[model samples]
Target: MSIIVQEQTGLFHLQSSGMSYIFQIVEGYPVHVYWGNRLKHREPMSDLLIHTPKKAGLDRLPQEYPQYGSGDFRNPAYQAELEDGTRITELKYAGYRIIKGKPSLTGFPAVYVEDEAEADTLELELVDAYSGLQVVLSYSIFSDRNAIVRSARLVNEGDKKLRLRRALSASVDFQGTRDFEITYLTGAWAREGNITRKPLHQGETRFDSKRGMSGHQFNPFAALVTPQTTEYQGDAYGFSLVYSGGFEASAEVDSFGSTRFNIGVNSFDFAWLLTPGESFQTPETVMVYSGQGLGELSRTYHRLYRTRLCRGKYRDQERPILVNNWEATYFNFNADKLVSIAEEGAKLGIELFVLDDGWFGKRDSDNSSLGDWVEDRRKLPGGLADVAGRINRLGLKFGLWVEPEMISPDSELYRKHPDWCLHVPGRRRSEARWQLVLDYTRQEVRDYIYDSLSAIFSSVPVSYVKWDMNRCLTEIGSAELPPERQSETAHRYVLGVYELLERITTAFPDILFESCCSGGGRFDPGMLYYMPQTWTSDNTDAVERLKIQYGTSLVYPASAIGAHVSAVPNHQVGRMTPLEFRGDVAMSGNFGYELDLTKFTEEEKEIVKRQVAAYKEIRGLVQKGDLYRLKSPFEGNESAWMFVSENKEEALVYHFQVMAVPHPPQRYLRLAGLHPELEYEVQSGDSEDKPIIGGDRLMHLGLPLAYEQKDYESGWFRIRAVNPGKA
Candidate 1:
């Protein structure tokens, strides 16, 4: 534990169980009936109060309630009820210490605040890990009800330098119910309208909520489906409003399971490597409510998710199992090679064939050919339409990949109009993964992307698009705009992308889009507002994937995680895990494969057949069921994960040993969110038990954790077919 409070400022502290990071609220500015259980201070800490504009006088600030109609607290705050109950007061006291801030030794200083109108907006300046490394994040805050207001920017005054080797994050907490249900998801990096293809409106960049959700993603970010609640129990619910983003994320609820949150993160954007000077950030929020289902949360978020379309009509829920060719083919191609794989894929019940990153242009690899959206006839003699036809004939939906915002220097588009890239025309530009970022803030560029994609979808029975944004913005200078408008590009770029997605999804309701940034570089709530699912990771090995997927599931639903079985000697980690084990592990979420099945041996094919069979059996349970995280995957001992039936009729449990030992005795494990009085028959299958399972038996008897020597590697876990709600 560490507590380092600035003199006369709010108390500062941080601690962890070593497995997960934990934070406690100490003394701070008192709000309307400021409500947090006082934590025991183990060490001597000074009690100090620091207020801004001190001479303004702290009196008349209202102790029993908030200064109604006073001002905005967009930085983030916890709320205490109002005096008359007409409204609630939320306050975000200033903190002197920064978790990760500006002039960072390596990157830039960063902070996020809701625009006065309350849309997630960020302000920062970062160093480029890659050359031409300059970044600008600025936006005017006003308009939307959920927007951020004028935020105090963290700056690099030249004298200060900071470096963050690992992911540096800033979290904004919401003041909500201790007893409430919260929902979160990550996807969407697109939208519709001209939003900002011109004189960067730093002031008008917020959505007009009165318009009933216009120009945002498929869903909006941080929604409160139900009204706030002020109840929590045990040692839980401290930060009733807190959110973080890194390689992965998670949340903790009390034993009731009553305070449920079906947090769904767009599975793609699995991981990112930000070296010394790069900066990364996410728009995180806390949705507070007391009781209800996931639908309620969706309803609230959708209400605020500014868009020109209606999600109610497009509620075509359920993400399809996708087979991405990138992991299999790796840019080297031939239509024949893909067709062969699609044939096997159809047989295994794969629903979509996503041709990732290389089906177009002179793009033989990731190095070149990004901006040229035209089909590269050299790779596929017959063209994209022909490839789509072949895949459709194989009884599967065809999906194409496009990094629409990037242009390769070697490509036709880039060569023809070099000035089209994000640069000052005379100045140099930055490049990552062998491609330059297209200026999305430009109207013509955005139009080209929208038109090209709509044309492509029109040419074939394309059901999905794997929209990829491989890197963050850098060396920010756009020659197409005036100097004053140049800094507005970053914010405008986002709005432009959202504008494109809104139009596409509205036009093609049947077509689904998956957002990906590198392997999992840009996993944020902003993205989830558009796409329903995302590629969880580039790492497909089962053993290593368990942790990656586990951490992902903390705030995201299983349905959003795009997991697949690929050839062993996992490309990323190089661990040669068994094919069955890989398939079985992936079965826990959106199931698919990343390897070339056509090249697989006969035995491997048979294993896939069985794997498909297993997936079909557990699909419903995994998609809609209640999830539980048993042991720490980060910890070497026994690790466990399970999915309980949506209706509580069945339960599927899967356990793996990170580090196994011989002669281990039967260990007892306590199941979470289970009822004791309900007698449950533990006869294999994911189910809801009807009979009295008994609290004593459940709590006292405990679950059998120690498996037989052979059962350990064999991956032993019971699939209890339950009859919940019965006698």
Candidate 2:
């Protein structure tokens, strides 16, 4: 059993192979006991929870779910306002139940168990005797992964309506600990997921997103590691929120040197009203502990998320190498032009041809035709089905791009229903990218969009859909919601989007869905639940992607990142990189091309053909193998990483240099995730020498890189174990 209860001592311990999370009910208050490397069951576990002096009060003790107005000055996990306008409430431990499997968060995205025996869940019930507000904190310990999935459910048991002012998912108190540094991902627009680390201070340090979606500003992930922690050494704790909307992750050090960590939905401009018998379920937060180091912590997340969080047939399958026409023709391409590009793509071994925006209503550019899903006869004289047929005839699958969440003023849908967008009647309706956010909070609006999209999806032989949301929310007031319930609009809108996705993805299970928000803006686990991959960024520059993809790997699996090769004098940044370097960078993730293939020179076309063929040879290993980041792009001019197969039979190592230096020091790239005793053969494109070496020697001594004289140079090595069984 992964979870153990010491009823006589009022203690509950959730244990995994490498980690343990323990808590105790002390005089009706749940108190955090220990969370770190696993301890023996026979050890003196009760002594771990020391009782503080009465003079110190509740603030001094490590609380499991601290509440405000209870002497705890730190931020509370939840806050509620009563019918009598009072805010103070005390919750006592009521009871708990151990379940066989993890329960899904109603109307939310979470990590799930396919089989009942995969995990054990402990539901700790707490209740406020005065108001009948019941809070159930759920903790699920996975049998295989070193993670604890946590969430909260607030039930309004009383007859009176309970207004929840702030509801966060989970909070943990690191007792007697302050020697920690926080690491998080932060960036904007074209540059998303830049890794940043700083020491934890006395006050609160928070990273959040308030732009409606989990914006490009900061990812809903944070880690606490000692100053001595490195990639492969020391202790680390990771927290990730499984939500797509606004979120907050914070770490605060108290006066006594204890640190409190919390993560969940951002309570900004948010409130939930729970009527009698109604419940509000917060999104789940995944907690990972690694005594070995950050590398192990990240690998645990990668394995769990790749296998459990991401579902459907494509979860374990290789992603197709696609060519999206967005950067190729923009909105200016006609049917013949698109067919020519797809025809070229087919010659280059590209598997999918995606017709981007402007195939819809009067959408010449980003200015119009957002919500209107109908085909634009001007660009495609013969509807989408005809274009799809043309691409299908070229031995390639067909894909379409649609921004179903935005409404353009010039579109027929908006003109017919002006009130369909999220806006205050008297206030100015803010338009971004010349479009307004659709009022997804309204069922009728969602139904209409679903009907419009389903009609087209069913008509065409579409194999994939790039679901893009170009803009964030503004004037967020919903016309369908009352003034008192206006604050609920953002969360409700997220739920509404999830509802629509559930319908579409469930209906067309064969069609691959890739989520995009003007690029990587909405790249989050919540979105990953529905869409297997995300367009990593609009900036397809190889040099820039070195950092973007490197930082994204901190939390997201490489299979979920949609990286592509674009034209030189890159669209986002005017930095010209070698075609080979661009292809090498894009091949690290879900491989694809975003440029017009028909215009490539014969030499360039040949390079692309080789790139496509190389990707096909390694796609399976790259998509499902374990990733080992050898060097960080943010730390130097060079970047390197490796992907090792699960069975330790094959591996791919990628290295990139942004610029060359004269008389540079000789560097060796040490590899990881290989069988230490096995012998392997290493081969690279630039060299014919297939050196056979022991894996232990490769990891300890490493492979040497030959100095190159050019800028934007890159290389990849394919490694295969020799005689695996004999070894």
Candidate 3:
């Protein structure tokens, strides 16, 4: 059993592969005592609780989920309003059980397990005796990974409807720290996932996304670490919300110096109605602890999410090399032009051809024809079937892009059913990208979207879909919901979107789905539960991508990052770089192309073919290997990263120099995760006479590199283990 409960002391200790979490009942409330490295034996700490006589029964003790207006006043983990309009909630422990398998969220996406041998779960029940509100907290511990998934389900057992003002998914209380820091991801669109770390103060520090969709400004992840913690040293704790909706993650330090970490659906402009006999489940929060520092914490998250969170055919499979038409032709292509591009891509060994936006309705520009799903005769006179068939005949799979969450006011659908959009009765409907958001909370609206896309997939032999949402929410109102329930609009919108994706993805399990929202605006774990990958960003410049990709690797795996090589004088940054540098950076992710190949010169075409062939050879290592950040772009002008296979048989290293200086010093990069006893042979793009070095020397002594190139230059190398018996 992963969980052990002491009958005498009312204590429970949950253990994962290398971590342990402990909690106990003090009086009637569950209080968190310890969470860190796993103990070798079951020894209860009698001195875990600190007795405070100054504020008796106040906010001294660390609680699993603190309640407001109940004497113990700090930030609350659960808050609600009764029918009588009171916001007080006094919840006491009711019961608990240790089970074998994990439970699923009712209307939300969560990590799951197939068999009882894979994991064990503990369910703790708490009830507010006055209001008849019951909250069931679940904790699942994987048998082989250092992770625990936590979530809560609220059941209304009273006759009156209960309005949820705040419902956080998970919270953890840590003992007082000497010095603490919080690390989170923050950036704007086209430059997402820049890691920022700061000292944790006495008050509250928060990272929130309230734009209906998980906005580009903040990702739903947070980490707590001591000031001495580094990438490969000290202790670190990571917390990630498995949700793509608006969310809030906060770290609060109390007067006594202890810290509380919380994450869930953003309570700002958010509410849920729980009538009698109804229940609402929050999304899961995955927590991982690493005694070996931030790098191991990231590797744990990467391994668990890559195998358990993401699903379907493309989850563990190598993604096909695709060529997108957005950067190439935009909205200026016809059927013949698309076919011509597909032919050129096929000759260069690209496996899939994606026809980005403008193939549906009259979408000649971003201003019009969004919700109309019909094929436009002006652009593709032969319709989708004809175009897909032509692409298929070229020995390439067909992919189409659609922004289904937004509707143009000028489109036919909006003209017929204007109430289908999210608008108040009198206020003007705010628009982004010249379009209004659809009121997905309406079942009718969800049905319309699902049926429309289903029909298209059935008509055309489409093997892939680039599901996109172009803008964030504006004018937060729902026409179908009541005035009191207006605050439920944004959260319910996300639930509806997840439902639609679940239905479509489950129905077409073989098709590859990639999520996009104005270029990574909604990149979170929840989307990866449905789609295998997400477009990293709109910026394809190699130097910029180095920072973006490095920051993203703190939580996400390389397989989930959609990267592509674009035309020179890059569309986003307008800086020309070497083709090799672009290819090296792009190969660090799910490799593909976003440029026009037909216009490439003979030499450039040869380079493209070489890059495609090279990526194919090491794609498995790049996608599924353990990532080690040798040199951070944020810390220096040079960025160096390495990927080593789990078996330690193969490795790939990427090194980049952002700027060149006269008479530069020689640099040596020490590799990671290699077996010290094994010998390996290194190779670099058909270069011969490479030395055979021992893994210990490579890791401890380091590999030397020449840094004499100009600005924005990069290089890659591959190493294969030499079997002792053969040598």
Evaluate model 1: give its TM-score.
Answer: 0.63
* Cα RMSD, model 2: 1.1
Number of the predicted model whose lDDT against the real structure is largest: 2
TM-score against truth, every candidate: 0.63, 0.99, 0.98
Candidate 2 yields a Cα-based lDDT of 0.90
Could you list the CA RMSD of all candidates, in the order they appear? 15.4, 1.1, 1.6
Per-residue lDDT tens digits of candidate 2, residues 590-698? Answer: 9999999989999999999999999999988888889999999999988999999988988999998899988888899999989988999999874788999999988
Q: Stretches of candidate 2 above 4 Å error?
A: none
Candidate order by lDDT, decreasing, is 2, 3, 1
Comparison by TM-score, 2 against 3, better one: 2
Sliding window of 10 residues with minimal summed lDDT for model 3: 43-52
Evaluate all candidate structures by whole-model CA lDDT and list the values in order: 0.49, 0.90, 0.88
Task: Please identify which of the two predictions, 1 or 2, would achieve the higher lDDT against the true structure.
Answer: 2
For residues 1-727, could you state the per-residue lDDT of candidate 1 as single tens digits?
2223323333332221111111222222332211122334434343322223544332222121112233532211111121233232222233233222112111111123222222322233333221222223222221222122111222222222332111212222223234333332332222110111111111111111110111112122232233332111122221111111112222223232212122221112222222334333322233322133332222222223312111322223555676778778898879998988899888877778988777777777678778777888988899988988999988888988878878888888887888777776566677777777777778888888888888888887888877777665566556676653454455445556666776777788787766666544444444555665666666677776776676555445566566888876778767666676677678887788887877888888777777776677667767666676666465666667666654554566777765457778767665543555455555322234434354336545756664445432424334343445752
Task: Give the candidate number with the greatest TM-score.
Answer: 2
State the lDDT of candidate 3 residue by residue for 670-696, as single tens digits: 888888888999876557857898989
lDDT of 3 at 443: 95
Candidate 3 steric clashes:
0
